[model samples]
Target: MSYQALYRVWRPQRFMDLVGQEMVTKTLKNAIITHQTSHAYLFTGPRGTGKTSAAKIFAKAINCRFSKEGEPCNECETCKAITEGRLNDVIEIDAASNNGVEEIRDIRDKVKYAPTEADYKVYIIDEVHMLSTGAFNALLKTLEEPPANVVFILATTEPHKIPATIISRTQRFDFKRITAESILQRMIYILDQKNVDYDDKALKVIAKAAEGGMRDALSLLDQVISFGDNNVTLDNALLVTGSVTQESLFNYLKFVLSKDTTNALKEIQQIVEQGKDANRLIEDLINYCRDLLLYQQAPEMVSDGELGLLDDKFKELSQQINVTQLYQIIDELNKQQENMRFSSHQSIYLEVLTVKLTQLSTNSEADRVSNVDLSQIELLKQKIENLQRKVDNLSSNTVQTEKNNEPRKQVRKNTTKGQKNVKINLSQVYSVLNNATRQSLNELKQVWPDLMNMLSVTQRAIMHVSEPVAASENGVVVGFEYAFLCQKALEDQELIDTLENGLDRLIGKVPSLVLIPVENWPEIRSNYLKQRKNGAVVIADDTSEQSQDNDDQSASTQPTIIQKAEELFGTDIVEIKND
Candidate 1:
């Protein structure tokens, strides 16, 4: 026989041998003992959490002729046949490869036949979420109502992708990720059975590196064992896992906390020279800082099993740094970690992070040195008084200039009565509205959806409730559903620029954007039309007196507006009969 991997050699033969899934195994065992097993079962969880293993164990246990206490007796021919993968009665299908309707239809056709030699015909579908939509639909009928001797076991890492109809027909079981402690104990047990001399700390490191997967832990353990010449030493495990040793992590943090940037960079250089990953080093440092925080708050609760607890040196350093400073360092490192993913120059980011961490302490020391001296207090006060006197003189001059300019502002206000009350360049928007040709607007409206699709999600959401009510060669007036939305749209300069670019792409011209509330659209249109009819160019003004004069002019022009309103709203709604 060829050399088998540790994971395959140590594959759990019985449910009791499975680690970290007590609840699922107990439930399946009870169902088998009570002879109340469902026809179909769905196992969903992260990869390597014993979903397929449990399915195989359950299949063997249910069909074993000499089953003992709901456990499969591997001595039985029926159990042995399934274990060796030579049984016609038991089938394991990889849905990733056979995820077509034709493959599923074949299963549907074969599901009608009875088991040849076993009590049941078991079908274990791995990565069942990979099945196509048509394949899933084809399997629904057979899954919902299979033969009495048939059982379907569907396993997938992502359960949310499976159709609800298929999930509803099966008894779903969600497997959780195995804990590090559980993985550690399982590795120790396997090493002990193999008579391999290993360090306990090394096993813990392997367990941490596994990230809650038993298969991954065993595979890493196998690699470390070979690297250590069958002796699983701490150094070999650290090298195999590419994990920073506890001493190196403590020394790196010590240099950072002490504000020694030179030594900190040196430590990073040493770590890089040893072929350690910068990203993994950052992650380990983050975990190390987290342990310090936990140890500071509750020393008794911090244990060696939880990603290696802080040592004496780390505990001493923890007291030197306060919680706020530690949190800031962690936050800065996390941001750097995110940036490192897209950057090829990862070492540069790491060095920058080192400098940032060292600066926190230096900045605090600088803040301490910046205290005011009592000897210079009187001099500072005198200088402040002189500054106040200069500010008062400047304020008086400003008031006098405003008073001298008041009459000129009033004269300008009278000149532009039908204009806006705010000082904005609305002449371009006004011209667009006045020369509002249907062809320009219709061209923009035709490609509005394409233009909108070019915007980001947030921009699309903000502009979804608005539409182009009026357009011209150089500007377009957009009307929004609510007043606040129009206000918000006008305030976002970036959104305006994006809209301009998008419009330029779609309509071949970058038009100025004008936003208005839909409720104010009619009044604004009426005012513009009234001003245009009076042969007046309405320039925008910010003076209050100008707004009041415009209101008075609107009241006087009601008779002309009524004639225009009759054309739009009909004579009945206009009601110009002596009113």
Candidate 2:
């Protein structure tokens, strides 16, 4: 006999042989035992979940002459004939290839006839969702009221596509995805029956890679068996599944957790050089992180058998990073996974992810510093209120002084040569400074990438040179890399509108734009600070002298927060507001 695949050769012949669908199998067997089997039955689930196999087994059980307790005796002539696909009474249809009104009409016309040899005639249609709309309509009436002793079985992976009218006329059985444990047990049984040498770890790897599909697991096992010359080993399983070894994943994660980007990149380079897929490496890392997180939360829940070769180092690493850091890493890796689908330069993203992971600990620390306690927040609020009161007093004095002075009528004049020109929106700049917060600014920065993604290619390119530097509730200050781009961006009303729409979609609010060139940012910011100092009363929140010292130190020791904000928002739209 010619070679047959293990999945085909070991196809389930009885409900008892089927794994991971006890509810479905038990229900069908009970229906047969009670002699209350429905005329039309619909089976739905993921591929290789045994929908078709269950349908076949049910067909044999209903027709077998020597059936006992709703189970088919395979030795019977009727069972053997159906199993061999030569039974005249039992018809198997592949709806994918023959999904047309004419084919269903033919079935509809033939279902009225009685069985030729068996007690009942059975029709098994696989992938019934592939049937055309008209074909489904044709099958509906016959399915609703079929001839006596006739059974119809319709199976599909996608139950949503089937028409409601057709679905209402049949008994629906939802087959679930087979569990890994069940799949492993079944594979071990088969291996033992065949007297094949196999490693338990190799079987586990196969089961995990199958992703709840028995046929897929068996097919992978068959390939591994052939590749290993009848002895299934862990190495063979990894080669077949394109899965990284546990040691490699652990080492890569260890490098990331320890903030060793250089070693991490070297490890990735080695993996890539060995012909391993960059995407797969990322997937493995993400899974490892997930396992580590799970292990941390419920150590007893996670078994080494299920995860396939876990080491004590995973638990140690879990202890090294908190849950928040692990969640952030997983989220970033997931985003990279999505990016990999669209990007041809997957390795670049992988390298970028490695660097990002190494920085998570530092970023978390910085976040802790920025997220002050409630008492500190209340103190900051009281100081802001005090400053507001001082500003009010200063404003009243300025208004009285202006009223006391005479109003001068000025003549309209044009600027001449050698005049230093300054163009700044003082009112808008003041509003942003008054309302700015580390939290709101960080919020905008977080969604900036998403906003950019929503923009058209042209708009993104036009606005790429700019970023949000300072943000208020009602407005944001955008800094441009080049003065010309800033000028152009201001002139392009359509681009601004697109940005507003994109902001609304991504961040749920849009703010007014305050565009300034990077070259002119320092001058503009200095002028605003000078105006605030000259026009407002200095309160004793942080002594005026200390505030000045802090300002000078901030400028000298590091860039001002505004400068850091400029870098973060990037010469683009810095912030957005609802109004």
Candidate 3:
């Protein structure tokens, strides 16, 4: 026979053999023992967490004639046939390739027949979420009312993509990621069984690199074993897994925490030049920092197998850095990590990250405060007192002037004189009011806050004092509490465009903006109402020839009839003339 991979050779053959999935295996074993197994089972979790393995084990245990306590005897003919994929009753389907309506219809047709040699027929579909909508519908009826002595097992990494109806009909078991400790122990067991001399540190690195997948751990271990000529060493494991050694990470962090930018950049350059992945390097740093934090909080909890990066040097470094500095470092690294995802130049980002980390201060604010000079504190106190005295003198002077000169009325007059009036387009305001409806006004009000949130801070501040008083399909008249804000809002073209786009997305169309002071709005409305009561047409008296010329200029700037016709058809067929 050809050389088989460790993952294939070490595939879990029984419920007890499927490591890191005790809950799923225990429930399945009990279900088989009690004869309470559901006709349909949905196994969902991350890849390599034993979803398919558990399904196969359950199939064998239930079908084995010489089973004991829900455990299959591999010696039995049925168990051996299922294990060797030669059993007619236990079928395994890769839904990724055969996910079609016709394929599922064939299964539906065959489900009625009894098993050929076994007590029950088991169908295991892997990556079941890859099934088409039509296939899902086709299999729905069979899953809903499966024939006697028939079982359907669906396995998927992403259960959310499966339709809710199919999920509801099956008993679900969610497998969790295997812990690092369990993976490390499993690797040790396998290595000892093979009589391979291995360093425990190498096994630790391989387990951490596996990131909770037994199959991945075994695969990595296989590579490391082959690379080391059957001896699993730390250097070989690190080389195979592309993982940074604990010492390298500790030295890099030491440079960073000591504010040694030169050494830190050199370390990063060396790591990158060694063909270490930028993402993996950053991830290792992040994990190293997390281990330092954990070690600081609970030293006993930090073991050699899990977070093995926390060595004695790491403990000493953890003491040098405080909790606050760790938080800032992690936050900065995380932000840079996100930026590195979309960027093609990762080495430049890594260099920039080195500079940022080195520039970060190790001293917390409390430490700085404690080291402050007493003389400087007294000097600051004197400056604050002097400012307070000046403010008090100005307040007294102002109060005296107000009492003597009746300054309130004078100040009001001066304020009114200094404030510039924003000229309201009364004609446009009247038109909007005439066509306005409660529904339009309510719609504007509903989306007002969301629109405000979308604007920049300065734009939002300008629009803060404004409210939509009347609205129509074509325009909205906004009443501002202050005249200055109204004036500022009218002048901001970017703000106007932003509001138009935002409102268009929310309420279906953009409307023209009309700005006026709140105090002026009531007076304008009252004047228009009085003119209507007196049987007079309400029109702006400022409709002079210059205004008409301005309107004509604006109209001419708009798309002309010929231009619009060209747009509707094509510019190739249209002609323009200056005359």
Best by the lDDT measure? 3
User: Each prediction's Cα RMSD?
Assistant: 16.0, 19.0, 15.9
lDDT of each model, Cα atoms only? 0.81, 0.78, 0.83
411-477: candidate 1 lDDT, tens digit per residue: 4344332322221224445667876889988988888889889986567666777888899888888
Where does candidate 3 stray beyond 4 Å?
Answer: 304-309, 361-579
Model 2 lDDT on a 0 to 1 scale: 0.78
Model with the higher TM-score, candidate 1 or 2: 2
Better of 2 and 3 by TM-score: 2
Q: What is the lDDT of residue 182 in candidate 1?
A: 93
lDDT of 2 by residue, 134-248 (tens): 9988888888788988988999999999999999988999989888889999999999999999999999989988989999999999999999999999999988888888888
TM-score of each: 0.62, 0.64, 0.63
- Each model's backbone clash number: 0, 10, 0
The candidates, ranked best first by TM-score, are 2, 3, 1
Worst ten in a row by lDDT for model 3: 544-553
Q: Residue 308 CA error for candidate 2 (Å)?
A: 6.0
* lDDT of candidate 3 over 1-579, digit per residue (tens): 999999888888889998889888889889989999999999998888888888888899989988888889989899989989999999899999999999999999999999999999999999999999999999999999999899999999999999999999999999999989998888888988999999988888888999999999999999998898999998888888888877889889899988999999999999988888899989999988887788788877876446454567777887988888888889988999999999999999999999999998777666678668666778767775665565456557745764675544323231132333365667688778778888999999999999988986557657776789999988898988765567677678898899999899988898988887776666667766887899887665332111111211111232456646644654345556567
Deviating ranges (above 4 Å) for candidate 1: 307-309, 361-579
